[model samples]
Structures are given as C-alpha cells and as structure tokens.
Target: MDKSAMSDPQQPATVAILAYPEATASVVYGMYDLFMATGRDWGIVTSGEAGPSLLRPLVVAARAGPLLATNEVRIEAQASLQECSSADFVCVPDLNIPPGESLEGRFAEEVEWLRRCYAAGATLASACSGTLLLAEAGLLDGQEATVHWAYCDELRRRYPKVMVRAQRALVVSGEGQRLVMAGGGTSWLDLALFLIARSVGVDAAMQVARINLIDWHAIGQQPFARLARTRQVEDAIIAGCQTWIAEHYCEHSPVAAMVRLSGLAERSFKRRFQLATGMSPLDYVHRVRLEEAKQMLESGDDPIEAIANAVGYEDAGFFSRLFRRSVNLTPAQYRRRFGSMRRALNAGV
Candidate 1:
C-alpha cells in the first residue's frame, strides 16, 4: 500500500488483532470489543447520529479452527492468517505465562505472519508479554521497546539487541512510526487510544475514551509495580544478603553491612549481588526500604519525616526526592492516592 493510500481519510483503516493459544481472553476479546465500539457506537448513542466507523477490527488466528485462551475459553477465528492479505494496524496481546518461560517454538507461524504483515506496510503493536513475539520476529532489534515490568529482564536476556524501556507506558519506534509497544498487561488500552489518535484523530480517540469511561492518559505501570517481587537465586551468599537486607533495611548504610555479611570483598559482593538479583546491593537496599515505606504510607498516619526515618533515611527531603523518582509519585501524593483507613475498611482489610 502506498503512503497516500494509508493516509486516506475516506475509508476506515483495517485493524487485525492476533489470537493464539494461551492468550488472555480478556485482552484478546476486550481489544475487539473496544475498537468495534469506536466511532459508530459512541455517535449513535450520544446524539442519535451515525458516524462513519473509524476502524475495521478482526481477530486473526493462525489456523482455520477454534483457538483456546489460557482459561479454556474458546473463540473461533473470524479470519485466518492465509485470509488476511494486509492490515493498517496489527495488535498482539499478552500470552498468559510466567515471565521467564521461553516462547521459542510456541508460535513460529504467527511470528512469520507478523513479519510478513510488517514488510507489507502494516504498523505493528504489542502489549505486555506480546512484545516477546515482536522480538522473536527480529522487528525490535536495536529499537527501544517496552514490556511488562516482570518480563523486562527476561526480554533483555533473551534478545540482547532490543532496548527494553521498562518504565514507559507506550513506545513508538521504526521509521515512519511503524512499530509500537505498550508496557504491562493493561497498557493495551493505552496502545489502542494512541493508535486511534494517530490514525483517526485525537478527537475521535478522546470520544472513545469518554464513551468507555477509561482513564486513558493518567495511568502508567510504574506506580502499580511492586519493587519487592522475589527472584530465585542459586548463590547462597547473595541469598543470605537478601535475607539480611530485608531484616535490617531500616539501619543506616545497610549495603555496607550486607557486604560485610557476605564475607567477600566489597567488589566481589557487589558483582555477585547484581548477578543473583539483577540489582546492585545499594539498589536492593533502596528497594527494600521503599517497599517498607510504601506499606507504612498506606497503612499509617505517620508524617513523611517519620516514615523517612523509619526507612533509614535521615534527610526527609532527600527521601522524598528519591521516592518520587523511584515510584513516580511523591510521598504525600502516594499516601493521598493509596492511603485511606476508610477505603481499607470498606474492602474488609
């Protein structure tokens, strides 16, 4: 397709969503439902006006048969890979699996299909673990992309050429913005709105958001991420340091103490710590402190200074700055947004 044909304002663009085994049903069908409701549903319901549909969304399966989602929910493919000649946009949603699990030979044909579509001028987009497929297809080589936070390490390990931006909500790469990636599982919504705005119009995307009541712009995965998620390690030295840090994170200069506990030279301890946990000793201590501080902020009425002192930071101002950088929200803002005895009580906590 020519550039002019792609930019044509008359006809609705074709949006093909890929479905495969072990995919999350919510993401697959939710995308179809959201895009399908775009221009037509909003216009008719809002003012009884029939607006031109902005997109032709279809679920494409590799085989010409039923596809089962992770929970055994079955969906028949509306179009097979052989049937889809071309598309303006292609979406790959998350496949429900552990982050470290290899997807090497799981969907070879789908990877090739994605490559063929991209070569034929389709803009490719992926959400959550679906970025794995893009990397497997060699589409993301040497390009900045985002993946779900838990999978960032695995993605980097598996494909050393891809630049993984774990913090970003949506990343657009390639010349002419032909490649896009959305971070986290729910970021598919962000990707959808972004594509709609870029292809259709900002007004159309906003209209869809309003109709669906989605907080499209205000969400990113950073704030919701838990910094204390465990990593299994075989190194006994690093394991002991991890346990020590968790128990003594409130002490001053915990990294020095952890290094001493490791019974190795400081440099060797730092190297081994990073190898085992994918973070520096100092970073691990900071994460431990931040995790505790977050719990205190959510459950208690302590002042910021008190929380800082409890977390081993003497300077509350410095702690606040670090907290903002790490969590993307200030201490006060975090408490106000997440803290609330009333809300906790309502949830039966």
Candidate 2:
C-alpha cells in the first residue's frame, strides 16, 4: 500500500457533510467552511507556505444533485454517496421542521448510508433534528444521545431503546468514539469546532474559531430548557398531578398536597409519580421550585436568599446547591448569564 494512502499523519482527512432536502443551510455550509478553513488556514499559519492540507471537506447527498435548504435555497451536492464511498467524518445537519412533524422514513437511504459508514469505521455526527436520522438508523440504540429539547420527548417516545439526555449540549457516544450529537440552535458550530479539534488539532480549531468569532457555548441545555409541566406519560392521573404541581409548587409541603390531591394511596402515588415523571414526588416539587427560582433570578435583583425563600426553600444554602445540581449553574451564575433586570422591570404589564 502507498504510504500516503494509509492514514498518513501529514495527509489531509476527508470530511463529508451529508446534505438533504430541507436541511438547515447554516449547518451544512458552516461545517464545510469551518472544516476547510481550519485545515487550509492551519497550514498557512504553521508553514507560511500552505503546507499539506489537514482536512478536505465535501458536501454529499443521497445522489449527486442539488438539495434544497429550509428557505428553498439551492445547495449543490459536490459528491454522492457512491462518489465519496467513505469519509473520516460524516456530519448530518439539522432538518428544519416544526413540532410534531414526522421525519419518519424521510431519509431512509441516507440513514442506511450512515450505518454503513459507521460500520466501515467513519465517525458519524449530527446536529439538532439530524439526530433523528441517527436514531432511525439504529446507530443510537442503547446509546446516550442529545437533541433539541423541544424534540427530546418525541425522540424518546419513538426510539425507546435510546437514552435521551436532552439537557446536554453535545453527547459523544458509540464504540471507539464513533458518534457525536449536537443539540439545537448554533450547536452545529460547536460540532464543527469539536470535529476540527478532534481530527485536526485544538490549535487549528481555535484559529478557525477566532476567524469565525465563535464563542463556544460550554454550557448544557439545562439553563435554557423549560421543563415540561406534563411529561409524555400516558397516565392521565399523573398528568393532572404534574399540572397541580406546576400551579402550586411554591406552597409549603407541596408534595404532601400533591399526594392528597392524587387520591391514590401514598405508596401508589409515589410509585406512579416515579413511573410517570422519572422523579420522586419530592424531587419533582424541587424541580418545579427551582425552575421558578430561575425565573426570579433572571428577571429580578432580589437577593439569592430572598429568591430561595420565595420559591419555598427555607434553607438558602440547600437551595443554592440544588440550583447548581439541576441547572449546572449557581443562581448567581445563571443571573449573570441570562438575567435582564432592566428589561424585565421596564416591560409594562
């Protein structure tokens, strides 16, 4: 075998951005541009002579043709699956879709191609709804995956075999580091930087990030996620208890109140709550209280202790710890990151 053909350290790595109809334009193009620039520019910076390229990126579709973006923008597929045959990395960009929309069998061939690529030793990745493709392909079975918080429930419902850690910004799983999933919004940017760092070098990824002015979001989705008042449980009684908790989470002894309202025996109510919400009644109550605390912390200048007290936490120290555990940020940190004291106070009722 030719030395250059074999995983040569000096040779460039090939990356394929899998484009499809209605895919998010930014993710597809951004992946190509970022990967290309990182490798090309890294060469420019290191040797000053544009040395051996570190990465080669191309857009691939089900076939060699033009694919449509969400806004009907046309993006040409530079290569087809057969044309590329394989890649060092494969990125499946988000397919922009509304809530409750089905991605069922939308890209069945592409999904199969992804499975093939993984089996052939290519690392597979996705952003936002693109994780749906991975899930449908069975690559995510019994693996930890993350997706847009809005679609987490649906993904879990549809693919019961996969564990959905919807609160994470990115999840890397599968055997031998073969799978990566990025959550919603501009997370494709994060994925791009991550891929560049992983395959190229961190210094090269940093160079590209500087050129793109990308402020990497190091945080997870917990801070931005609004926990569902009613989780996707089929039990109507449990759903009603969830609603009641949402309404009266700040009241003293809310869990006891919920149990009384549930009308089930104490043991039965506890069991059902856990089965439905994946949280004990007390944990559920604390979760709701902390969510309210977050709102107050973000929109008001009240002291942390005051906020805690208002949210039914008499022990401010304990509340701060709980907040940190749940939101992955202390109350103070969350306020600084997302609070708008002036905007909230100034907005007229």
- lDDT measured at residue 12 in model 2 versus the true structure, 0 to 100: 74
- lDDT for every model? 0.84, 0.83
Alpha carbon lDDT at 242, candidate 1: 82
Q: What tens-digit string does per-residue lDDT give for candidate 1 at 12-96?
A: 7888899988788788888887677778877787899867777878888987678787889997778899888688999999967
Q: What would the per-residue lDDT of candidate 2 be over residues 1-349, giving only the tens digit for each residue?
A: 1223327666678788998876877778878888778756656766785644568888998888887778888889998887777778889998677646776777777988898889878889899888888998999999999998777877888899999997789999999988999996788888988998999789888988886789887888788777654554588888888888778877898878878887999899999988887679998888788878888987789999999998888999999999998888999999988886446666755
Residue pairs clashing in model 2 are none
**What TM-score does each of the candidates earn?**
0.92, 0.83
Give the top-scoring candidate (lDDT).
1
Against the true structure, candidate 1 has what lDDT? 0.84
State, as a TM-score between 0 and 1, how close model 2 is to the true structure. 0.83
Q: Tell how far residue 192 is off in model 1, in angstroms.
A: 1.0
Please tell me which predicted candidate would have the highest TM-score against the true structure.
1
